[model samples]
Target: MKEIAIAGAGPMGLLLAIRLKQLGYENITLVDARAGTYTRPGILNASIFEELTQLIGLPVDFSDSYHLKDVERSLYKIAESLNIKIMKANFTGFEGKALRVEDEHHDIHILPCDLAIDATGSRRALVNEINRLFPDAFSVQPIADPSHKKHLMAYVKVEEKTDSDPPSTPAPYGFDFMVQKLEELRAMGWKGFVEPGFYALPLAKNKTCFYVEIPENLDASQHEKWLKTVVAFHTGKDNFDYTLLPASRKYGSKPRFLTFIVDPHQVNEAFFQHAQFPCVIPVGDAQIEPDYRIGIGIKSGAYRIKCLLDAMVLEKDQEFHIDFEKYQKELAAAMQMHAAALSKFYQEKQRSYEHYANLLSIYETVIASASMSKQKELQPSFAELIQAYAQSLYDAGNNALESILTSSGDIPLDKHGLIADEKKLEDAIARLIDAYKYAQGDLYTMASLKLNEIAHLYEKLADVFIQRGAYGSSLKCYEKANMIIEKILKDRAESVLIKYKHTQTLHKASRYEDMYDMACQTLSEIKNIGMDPEEKKKFTYKLELNKALALLHILHIRKDLEERDYYEDECNKAIKHVKSSPYLKDKHLLQLTKLLGEIPIESMCNILKDGDKSDLAADKSKRR
Candidate 1:
């Protein structure tokens, strides 16, 4: 049996052991430097539940322990359900495929294994040992923001409650409330607010965990006063009492210092100046130290374990060199994707907060006015509030567009002769006009601009076609525009803008069949595009008039009965295409509906009973 020794009894180490065991590697040992399990009041976020579930085949249940459940409880439940028994011991040192651990009696136990995983977390001792033993394999760097450390502190105690009392105490835990309180404190010359009412497990009946986070720079003397105020705010004086423990004092120290480093980037800079190992893998915080507030450390640790497992599985069959190269590439890709996602999330959040702040200011002003006797008869209604919110969104969109235009230098621009420069300038101007129109909910303006741009592009193509004396090809461009305008108006029946374009394009295209085809295709395309009833009516009139003329022309050309019958079949197919379209307006589509209705009832019933084979053949021809 393949034996693996994993250091650290934390979630990452435990999860790795469980996964390895499931993969048929059962002889495993989990070692922690501490003598026993370390207990501290820490919260876990719900994001890691999926990862936990995948590692161990179990669904997390949070209803048992905590009254106020969040992400943390979800994590704890998953961890508890793993079923893999944990053994506590101190990790003294390590040798090749062997580790030394001290038991309860202080007797050192040496165990041999196939592999030794350094899941000893962010300990400098383990890192230093690894670097010294394999100098060419490991690298270390200082964590950033080393000075801005603050400890996470929480208090837990049991209290007595009557049967009629609520299961969980009502408390405000949102960051907004904390920020507001902090601002209020800042007004009174205090650096930070005493954040209160953080929810936790109801350890016993009438007992609740009263949690508070204290920053490193808080005044020492004011700490007690702050705690008192927090306790009073969360639990009323009559209902519950408090017990502050000694362990809570340990959390009064500075928080962990974190560093954001890219290992491949370091390698490129030759920071691994004297590395010699076959594979020098850095996992968890050693790889990249993100902010603790984001709870990325746990996520990074779990991800690293999964990556290691993947590499190990691949290496079993593949050459060591190939496996190492593939692993490094995958690692780099994961890091880049993570960085991009994190950056985008924070950027969007900052923008959202700014928008919210502006809305709040406006609301405050309106409320103040309503409170005054000067505005006794005037008060903003619910609809007015909704309108204000929508306007804010529009304003934000406009601001975003303006920022892109002014600051984004990546957008191309030409600077040659006056005529060429003016054309490029016009294109840029048109783009900005479209953006502004979209922000202002001016759909007509957007449609008009798009059609105009398409026309100009097609006009240039037509000019090239004319120079080559390809009259048919030149006419196709005008025909294409005519079709587009027809569909636009058909769909947007009430739109004056689309009607004008449709009329103009239809006037330009000469061929009768081309005009008819354009109208048919336009009707089909309009099913996909947006349009109103009036726009639909205007376009429908244009389409039917063109179709009638085209059918008559085809009849005049094909004088023989058989040939005339073929042309009639083609016209019917075109009408069928418009009727069958998904976007066809039921009311406006009634033109084709009525035409089908006008056919003899017996013939219509026969056609419906025995589907048109000729129509099917025509569809197959179109596909080809």
Candidate 2:
């Protein structure tokens, strides 16, 4: 058996020991400064609990009243099921092949172990000591707050059966439960624990817990007053009822707040850099600081324990210290990925909150306007209401887009990632368009303009489609591109490049009539806009060539000789313009001249072979 000692009995530390035992690593000792196991439940998000379950090879039974219950109750159940005893008394420090701990007598007791692990939970004193003792090996920060200090939670246990099923009010149960409990407490004039920066949670029957926190350097008295007001609102009176627990007092102090926010896999980095640590390896909280939101701490701790176990079982000949460094890079990568995700979640929440506040204000105004008019007919129509909502939605989308454009640093942009988020933006735009189609207000025109802007965004989407070889979808995107181009032309008709591209897009889409009309418009626009003689001649030549092609097609389709002659005359005039142009000095111009030459030759050959030169000559002479 490989003897390993783990320090700290917090959730992460305890879980580490449990996972080690489960992996068949016997002779494991878990140490903490606390005399007994952790009794109160820690603040862990539900997602973290689910992650913990997967790491430890045990199902987390969160059906109980508390989501993150005391590790004593939860871990004990796991211990019984696995037949493992993973906990022990305090761990003072470590030496090679041994660890020291103190009993009640203040004497040090040394125990031999092959490996020592520091899983101490945010204990700055121990971290600093390690840094000092192994100057080059440890990276310790005394004032790090990985999770922002603004979060303060209160866990309260409401009195059971007091008002279990109060009247069936119109308020939602989830929203009103806390209010109802507060009312009951206020009626009782309960003077419970009142502390600054505190919130309450009801963990069990007739039991409540309060947690308080604040940002560093904040005035405690102001927070105290706020806490009193919150308690009064809850109790419906000016007091709280409950005894203050010692644990609450300990938590009330400004916490040292340290965060490892570094890459978790970099655990061995300090060791390599400093060449310290004779036998003990820091794991879990003692190893690195990870984002608290995603519960990476517990997962990383479990992973570290598993790594140690694997090394012991598979690399018995190699030293344990050397083996520990091998897994540090992997841990660092996992830590970085989790931290980045947590940062993104934080930013998104900030944006969503601002948007929600704006929407709430608009909704209030609509409600107020409806109330002011005595006549129900004076109220805004349903279409008007939807239009307002859709506009707000579009504005929120614009804010999100702005966020994306201005976002700094690296962000994930692969498929099913940030790109999927952009797709959601497209869906938002489509919904806005649908809203405009049904809206009766004058604002629909404004909405249409917004849709034009959205269509422009399709340029980015089109690039994505082209890369994926969805040519059919690419074609539809090009049509939308043309629609935007047309709108721009209507607004800025003098823009030559815009007009030119508009015609090109039409031709690409195979809209012959629209393309022909654009060519004629360009011809008139060049002369009317007062272009130089050379520029005008260039435009006239291209327009005449386009007209000649259009007329040739018309001639092929016409059955009547009179209509054919008319188209033939149009072609003749167009060919004359091309022949008289000074720009026909290049190979491309030579090619055009050659192709146009074939047209008259083919017509003449038909007339001569049929012995109808007199008729053809009469037709040509009439045109002349």
Give candidate 2 regions above 4 Å deviation. 1-9, 14-69, 72-116, 123-149, 157-201, 208-276, 288-300, 313-322, 325-477, 484-499, 505-510, 517-624
lDDT of each: 0.46, 0.50
| lDDT of prediction 2 | 0.50
- Candidate 2 lDDT, 1-624, residue by residue in tens: 256666666666667667766655566666554524344444555565666677776776664453444434576567556655443556666554566776556767676676566767555334445666767455553223222344434444443345442111222222223333433433333222111223355545565545443344435445444444445444444444543333445445422221112222224343322223335566666666554444566666566555555554423533233454555655556555545655665454333323433433544454455445422432333233445455555555555555544244111155543343556555555554544554445656665666565555555455555567554444555555545544433334233433454454454455555656766766666665554667557656766666555554445444464766555665677665765667644453444333333345355233132224444455556657
List model 1 lDDT by residue over 1-624, tens digit each.
Answer: 145566665556666766766665546676664413343344455556655666567654443332212233443334345444344666666655466777777888886654555555555334455567766445554333222233324444444443433222434443333333433333333332222223433444444444443444557665654544444444443234455444334445312211122221111111122222112234555454444345565676677566666766523422222244555666666655545544554444333323444444544455464546523422333233333344444345434434433243222223521122334434444443333333334544554544454444445555555566555655655544444444333344333333333333443444555556655665555556566756555565556545644554545444564665566665655455445545555453443333343332222223321234344344446657
lDDT score at residue 426, model 1, on the 0-100 scale: 40
Q: Tell me the lDDT of model 1 at 265.
A: 14
Candidate maximizing lDDT: 2
Instruction: Report RMSD for candidate 1.
Output: 18.6
